[model samples]
Target: MSAGETVHLTLDEVRALAKAGLAKTGLSPDHVDAVAETMVSGERDGCASHGIYRLLVAASSVKSGVVVPDAVPELSEPSPALVRVDGKGGFAQLPFRLGAPLLAEKARKFGIAAMGLNNVVHFAALWPEVEELTRQGLVALAVTPSHAWVAPAGGTKPVFGTNPIAFGWPRSSGEPFIFDFATSAVARGEIELHRRAGKPVPDDWGYNADGHATTVAEEVLSGAMRTFGGHKGSALAAMVELLGGPLIGDMTSLQSIEADGGRGGSPIGGEFIIAIDPAGFVGDLLAEYMKHAEVMFETITGQGARLPSQRRYEARKKSLVQGVEIPAALMRDIEKLLEES
Candidate 1:
């Protein structure tokens, strides 16, 4: 299978396959629909690593009783502008869908609102949630701590998750200015991809079991993934853990081990989202913000820099105009899974 080979599947075909796969495991149609929608959106947005590639893990987690398919979110109002939700071990998207709109409405009224979500599985990418808030004409910031995969600076052992943080601002153009990234040297999904492909990681991406830097994905997976920028990344990751972790009273990576039968637990990740109404802060802020952003963006591009989301946005546009280019290996895996189903 070549690395860049493309496979074309219509949106309906992809969703149908995901729904059928989930249904075979006794998942409800509603759950299947929601999950399938998220997965398809990820693929359409050119985030295939977090798309159907994760279906097997998600379904297995549900079937193994690690994730409660029908779990309900427990809401608590600690303050007028702050809401906390205990996911009760459900899929992460459940609380995201529920809380995002609530926060948006609250922000519209209060100028700003924040929600803390805990006890949910990994929420895929942060773009989807942020896009929703942007569509509502609000700026949104979402941060989450996942299963511990990256090591702290100067530490050999893994002590923190990849710790993704995302921010989104409304733009008048084709897409919102969305930025999502992991604090780790590389994303866990990328490492997993390398492992699945039997390829080595980059030397700077991780360390060996002996605490020495290495390019071997298996070694890093068995040992510790590196922090992105030494202490800076570690500090950011620590902040994410505190804000997205115990503040909401959810299980950290270490705490999750007790629940997931010791294979790193069920990814009881924690998340925090802040929504801000631009108009509340300043009149016609979107127009002004976009104007300034364009100037700065042009300056940077002129100096040989690209905006944060430009690559993904370009890939998405091309995919929509042409077709999604799924790698050959991923296509083969999808076919194999369909055959098994």
Candidate 2:
């Protein structure tokens, strides 16, 4: 879609849409606001696949009794530096809101704090959580498991999740240096985007149901997404699934059978967040860290490498200056849904 053809929705308008959608599911204003804020943040950051497009899915899951809006996270303080929260099949944003502050508090006291969350719905974007921790002068690392979308090394079957991992570090320049990415060759969302656009996937990105590599998006959707770097990516995906899926006694990709039955089962995924207080390790280390990071980043740029988070960061700046861009088709769909509501 051409950027010039995009529509700009104000934050208020986005919130209103989310509120109306959530209300249709019998959610209270407070929960609606929470979901809306997360959705708008994703949109503002230019993650369109995880932004407004997923709102319909979320609302539908709630209305279908797949997700419980009133479900409270069961919090457990297993250690001074760790917390485990069972999301009780509620919206993902709830555990994020509850865990972030607690982790920040614990990080302030200890050198680091880690939290494990389970049984939540999809967490749209990882940047917002990292942004929150960065604002608290802490570095945050987050990892989450997903449905089987990627194949293991030398294997044809879809056996692993996209399993994204994200990291955020505070900078002396006031803007956090954040990196968030999927272990797969491309995000599953990107594949979905191509499917929606009726485009083909890159041949290097995924394999067909018969385990042959192809550039057809439909084949990838019906088959398996490739890991980013072959065996290395497959290994990392496995590690992520271990840390972010079953390590905390949560379900894995193979364990998620509810979706097959047309019931909103817990996606049975897990997420882990670790917040670290830089000051605890080295006072004024933020400055030193930025210095090294800058040098490394400049070297990469000189070698024709772009930083991981630079694109989204630049997109966010432009959005703030010139309004966020929403595809005309998406806007039309959103408008139609709004009218229906």
Candidate of highest lDDT? 1
- Top-TM-score structure, candidate number: 1
Residue-wise C-alpha lDDT for candidate 2, range 83-112, written one tens digit per residue: 888888877777778777888889989989
Q: Which stretches of candidate 2 lie over 4 Å from their true place?
A: 1-5, 196-198, 257-266, 284-290, 298-305, 339-341
Record all residue pairs in model 2 with backbone atoms less than 3 Å apart, i.e. clashing: none
- What digit string (tens of lDDT, one per residue) describes model 1 on residues 189-291? 6887898899988898888889999888889987899888889999999988887878777767555544566654447767888999988867666578668
For model 1, what is the error of residue 217's alpha carbon versus the real structure, in angstroms, after optimal superposition? 2.3
| lDDT over C-alpha atoms for residue 205 of model 2 | 85
Q: Give the C-alpha lDDT of model 1.
A: 0.78
TM-score on alpha carbons, each prediction: 0.89, 0.88
Candidate 1 clashes: the total is 0
The CA lDDT of each predicted structure is 0.78, 0.77
